[model samples]
Target: MAKIEDQRIVIDCTCEVQLQQTIIDAVYLALKLEKEICFFGNYLNTSEKEHLQQRTAFYANFVKKDIPSLPVSVLLLEGKLNKLVKELGEKYNTILYCYSGAMDNRLLEAFYRSGFPFYFSKKQVSNSNQFSKILIPVDFRNSSKDSALWGSYLGRFCNAEIKLLVANEKNTEDQDLVASNTESISRLFNQFSFPWSSVLGNSSSWGIHKEAVKNEEPFDLIIFAGSLNVTLVDKITGTFEKRLVNLSEKSVLLINPQRELYLICS
Candidate 1:
């Protein structure tokens, strides 16, 4: 089994229809990764804290009923959402956030600035307890390695099959870099004895994610290495990470390329 430094998965609880499914998805991942679970919510006042606690308790109990052996904690945090998230990121390597079908700019910003990888999901759990197939879109950037590392971890620990979507760049230098990345990623997967396949994408680096999300092949999750720098256009519209997280129907595992990530050890 692969071991992580923290070995804890934090689930951000909300009062949305996606709440129950989020818990289920988190439990599934926690069990697979052999990590403890924490259900977290933010509250402003005493009344709100009580209400959030009740909501978290109800769902935590539901999860406990089925998986009695799992270690679970429920916490009501008091602070700005971004500050709270940054604090949590310091203690935990992974955080799970479920979208309520509506875009929450504050929540997205919190996750973006936290400098940690986050699992973003919707109302429905696509793979349920088994994340059998994972799609990773790879480009020439060094950050692509982080996403590949995550894929290898899941592939080794959760028995997931990795599918790499390679970006097709027109520039010779970029294309050469892309080839090198593909070779390196393939080598990593081979070293771990995990099953992975690669397919060339017919889009630019920024647009390959769209192709991956819209691909005909069924995938349980899409792992993306996001850029930290935001341009003026990105602000007016949204960053590529935000757009991918919002538009993807399948769950997305978003990794901050700028952060030094902790790898799973054998």
Candidate 2:
């Protein structure tokens, strides 16, 4: 439903205990969509490699217990991560990393530069049912619009409820931008068929994160948008947009501004 089929997902399995389930769940979710799931197995130690394979096999078997025709593959990590990603970039649509707070910022910048729909989660997320609540943070930028459409597609695919959070910034210019962004997003989502809503917020990441966690009903996903074509300079300078990825409590989906979803898939 999300054009997940016929897509390739390269998973970085170089994480430890707490992240193991994240990798397993990622593979399971991908298999459910019949996507080409590829695990980078070369960098892992023997035990880690074995664990990854065993868990992958378990999920694949579970997914295919009755379906019998799931698409999955195990690829060697081969060499450096950036190198592997460069190679995978030609074929894969998304590079998934089950990272905690330990990952280097440089590596993330590399993924952004690689122009893939880089999907990452710092915590475990359940794939047992459709995502019921997806959150999209809106700003007056083209990237935010891309994120809105992408989140809408995911909402439709999962039959989820999608909400837009227009963060009210401090200055008049920023506040006006948020209002304009909200209106534009409302018009855009109106074209889609899904249960959707919107709320104006008084702050960015912190407020949104707090609201998300404080909700008696939690959000299943957070989709962010930014100049995915990030530069070394931007990382050094530290952009607020880049900081949104640090929200590790829930599953976060980031749409690269440099890479648009293939129209064929749409």
Candidate 3:
């Protein structure tokens, strides 16, 4: 866990259909850990009066829920974030999400900064889902480094058989090049001490990537790294980060490279 400047945030617990379970998990986790929580939620969905009673385990539970966001409004989530933490007698804080990415993740990009502490689910799926296999997409980029490190740590925690996958792009003329490097992927996994079988999968093209996301056998979770500064060109363009949130029947944990975490709760 990493710690940043003493700033607390109030992330919106209010949301639509696809994200409801995650909000519950996030709020419950906050309450269960006894962290002084500033909740931004809907009265109908999650009321402070109802939820305060739910947080019985934590020793010092400081929380305030039910702050509404108007239609087409962008309130200073950071300010509210700090207020929540300060009210709870905490130091550093800000609001965040378990499944935010740069392109699609608004709450995070607004709040994330150098040396800021953050936390997301290491277990990347809803509590209702069960897993026997975990797929990790690994690359050598800085963003991928966070993905791989977190994936390894998380896979071990879940006790799932870890599959370390890498992308291999071979043009028609480069078949030999692709075949030659078959063993190299295994070598990379060995160096990391990640006990995983290797596969040639691309996030771009068909076949492997398609099957990876659409497997009928049930993956429960998919972990991959994407660009940190994910911006969109078109107004209607749905970012990949957002797609993960909407697409995953399970939970998606989007890990960026430079977040510090402070554990107010155990």
Candidate 4:
């Protein structure tokens, strides 16, 4: 999307869905975006022995159902495509999501090596750019503020309503702090002429995160930002981010310089 304008680009990434279907849906989203769109689909190349025929059949079905919509220069390639991506430049770019269920950092390194700038979930990059409504979970910490800034930016762009969520233990003191922060954010939004808004919940760290992601509402988008769980411990450290990546049915952005999980959206 380098040469493309900002509003003309959208991105969708998924680990589920038939590989070819994912590509087709991406094409649909891109076209609907009325801008350039690129969808990244990754298959475990090493697993070919188990499902090569099945995989091929899936792709065949996709072509049968949808490939006529390929809009000219949309380049689709597989294998260790890092080099091919470099040659193609940035007009269109993608890297493999193959991890062998190991969550290897090597894939992240490979993505950068391939020259793809930013990545996005299928929901975030969809044509629904305006926020008719949004749910943002925040703690009192500065980390939550990181998410706030991004959400505020989006709200300003879309003029959409907002909901700031927090989890509580019913303590009066914590409640007061939550009140102050909520007021501050609301005032900021009004100052910028953002739309209507409100806040809920308590200030626990994981509380805000889990509640926000697990919220049963069907808001247009939910954001958890700055750094979610970036502790030194092994499992739960990156695990929080991983859960959001794999488990989320919504678009989740897990950004942190330490984890090198920044999202590149043009």
Candidate 5:
């Protein structure tokens, strides 16, 4: 992670009042990383744009009082948000979108296929962006290693505790490898001085989500790795990835396997 301070973040500045919370959360992420924040300012007309500008400025000030150091910019969508995002995704390292649960599926597909690691969340972020506990669901795959590294980076950055949850069926063929992978992940996190632990369980994403919902202590963030879907078999029966995203309430950091993991900066 080469001091990843220069980040380009694109967020939809829709005029919906409900979206305001998510927008502020997104800005908080940018502030955490001191990254450049970009907004699609064309989503609103003159009066609405003025109101939104005020709101955005307020959030920016709330996060960082030093206005000169905060690199915030607005781009006109011109009714071509999808196309503009495709271009931006190619040029940027990190992209954060305010997912209001009603975005077009096609647009999301574009984000997935854009080859950039992106963040999506419907819930408001914590007032303090210091993630106390971070969870990474591990499977016996190369992408899981990538995800673990990311979790370690974030854990160190936030001075947080990291945990890797290994979920698998009892009858799975690679049970031994799963155990080995857990040990490997533990060692990796330990190198980063991240207090780490492991949880072994056989459950689906829905079950994990249910437990998190009921637990007194919930994870602040869940990190996931993107699948290539290279093989025909893997394409047909995708893992619990999508379900994990839909069923969880915490923030998600999705890593695109196609791109170099080093590009996934804070």
Candidate 6:
């Protein structure tokens, strides 16, 4: 775990219609967690790079107007986009990216492979960017812990309630693992005195997201753990990670399973 002050959120600034909403969401989170914001722009040529410098500055000022106390910076990243994103991921704990339907899958995949947690949304920022209810779909994987940790952080900062949607596993081994994972997450929440509740899904792990989206409770945020192993079917259709992001209208916080995530110190 790292001090909360050490956390920084990198916001990918683009010339998309949803850019304003993305900045609003990033600034809201930064204010809530007392973290700094770095507006990042990726460029291909010197001309574009120079233009991005000004663009990032404008966005920075946009955030500053709403959040005067928050610290902000701008970075013009040149060279490969994915490589630069990976490097940025190594430095920042979280990245905020908006899906604009144009090359969104590629942009999201880059973040996914970057091995960092990311907040993705196609719609506008949540009302006042207040996530009072968070949903975390749990399964029999170590990665579930990462998502749970994020859920606890949001729960603490936003004064939100956490709901763990546990997977219904038929296999004996998987059932034991799911139970173990669920208990561990519950203990983590209890340790922080964060309010949490759980419900068993009627479907297996594969169908968990469908169940989550259909949940009666209106969650402001959904924290999902990225799949470590992408199956062949995922290649043809799409990874469950992308599917969840696309399917859910609510904001999603994705935790990459392959990386060791940083936690906010209490």
In candidate 1 the C-alpha lDDT for residue 149 amounts to 85
Q: Model 4, range 1-266, lDDT digits (tens) per residue?
A: 33322322222222343333334434543444333433333344646423444443454455445655533222234454444444433434331121112223433334334432222343334444524567777665544555565566566655657777864636677667666666676667777776655556643655676767677256765665433334567343554545554555554433332322222243
Superior candidate under TM-score, 2 versus 4: 2
In candidate 5, stretches whose alpha carbon ends up further than 4 angstroms from where it belongs are 1-3, 15-18, 41-68, 77-86, 93-104, 124-126, 171-173, 204-217, 230-243, 258-266
Estimate candidate 3's alpha-carbon lDDT, on a 0 to 1 scale: 0.40
CA lDDT, every prediction?
0.75, 0.59, 0.40, 0.46, 0.59, 0.74
- Give candidate 4 misplaced runs (Cα > 4 Å): 1-35, 39-131, 157-159, 167-184, 192-194, 226-229, 232-238, 257-266
Model 1 agreement with the true structure over 39-102: per-residue lDDT tens digits: 7788778888888888789877877887888977777789767777766655654444443444
Off by over 4 Å in 2: 1-5, 23-34, 42-67, 93-102, 122-127, 169-180, 204-217, 226-244, 258-266
User: At residue 127, what lDDT does model 5 achieve?
Assistant: 59
Off by over 4 Å in 1: 1-6, 92-103, 123-129
TM-score of each: 0.89, 0.72, 0.51, 0.52, 0.70, 0.89
lDDT of 6 at 103: 35
Q: Identify the superior model by lDDT, candidate 1 or candidate 2.
A: 1
lDDT of 1: 0.75
Per-residue lDDT, model 3, residue 104, is 39
Better of 1 and 5 by lDDT: 1
Error of 3 at 231 (Å): 4.3
Q: What would the per-residue lDDT of candidate 5 be over residues 125-200, giving only the tens digit for each residue?
A: 5557636777777766556677787677667666778777775645455666566667777778768776888776
